[model samples]
Target: MAFSPLLDELVESLRCLPGVGQKTAQRMAFHLLERGRSGGTRLSQALSNAMDGVRRCDNCQNFADSEICGICVKPERRNGTLCVVESPSDLLAIEQAGDYRGGYFVLMGHLSPIDGIGPEEIGIERLLSRVKSEGVSELILATNPTVEGEATAHYIADRLADREILITRLAHGIPVGGELGYVDGFTLTHAFRGRKPLTD
Candidate 1:
């Protein structure tokens, strides 16, 4: 027997999620039908609410409901130290550490020239502007240790070469080609503490 259009649509929508295949989507649909009726309703509501209400902080690009995120607006975090990350997820990982008492600037993605993603797409210009306007004394590049992450860091460093701000990259303890989002909070904190300057 053929499935109804609504069921098919739910399955298709589930597949749009990361790592969800046809089988997984079908499983999810069945689970929703069984033990997840209320969950399904809540999921839909949460998705709609977040999509409509959540916006990027104009300065840091982190999720915000207003013009600036709470972290960016708080006066205590204004220590002239900024941590640059590849994405909001990476920023969250750093936040989980609770050791670094600085603000963040999320890149949202790394430089992928082959895929046509560049500085403009990642708002590098806006980042430069923030660095200059925010009176940032130190810039901690917390991008992942991956090739693309390194390339992105180098690109930013090159642009800010003449600036007096101290530029440093996350420590190599993160492992080569590893992502900041996947690293444990303790490890990330250690990495941040051990960060070194990005020399020529």
Candidate 2:
């Protein structure tokens, strides 16, 4: 059965979301039209507002509705330590962990030469400028453990080698409850390299 032109257009638009294929999009469209029109209207309004109002935070490059994000304006968060992450989602994850209390720099992406992403493309110059101006005492490279993430971290560390800031990379290894036999060799190697001396 063929859908009306407007319904077909709605289904096609729904497919723009990640992981939403034709069938899923059609299901969603049908659900919205049949039983969730109010909810769909709210979603549409919210999406339109966000699309028009949201922009990158001036300080951290994270998504924000204002010039600087709320985190960047907090007085207690200016602790001279900056955590660098690959995206706003990573920042949110660290925030949810409830241990870190410092500023952040969202790279928005990792270096991918094949994809034409470089230091400049990922706002490295802005990050360097922020580091110099912010009097950052510690710079934590919290990028992911992937090859591109590692390369991005190394590149940033090398750029800041002459600075007095204490540069550190987040440790990667097996999970707290993970069995050694189930862990991959790369993770085991990292765990061994990052081993700490047992305290008495």
Q: What is the model-wide C-alpha lDDT for candidate 2?
A: 0.95
What candidate 1 gets wrong by more than 4 Å, as runs, is 1-3, 174-200
Q: What does candidate 1 score on TM?
A: 0.82
lDDT of each: 0.91, 0.95
Write one digit per residue (lDDT tens) for candidate 2, span 100-139. Answer: 9999999999999999999998999999999999899999
In order of appearance, the predictions have TM-scores of 0.82, 0.95
The best candidate in terms of TM-score? 2
Highest-scoring model, lDDT: 2
- Candidate 1 structure lDDT: 0.91
User: What is the C-alpha lDDT profile of model 1 across 147-195, one tens digit per residue?
Assistant: 9998999999999999998999866558679999899887788789878
User: Model 2: how far is 27 from its true place, Å?
Assistant: 1.0
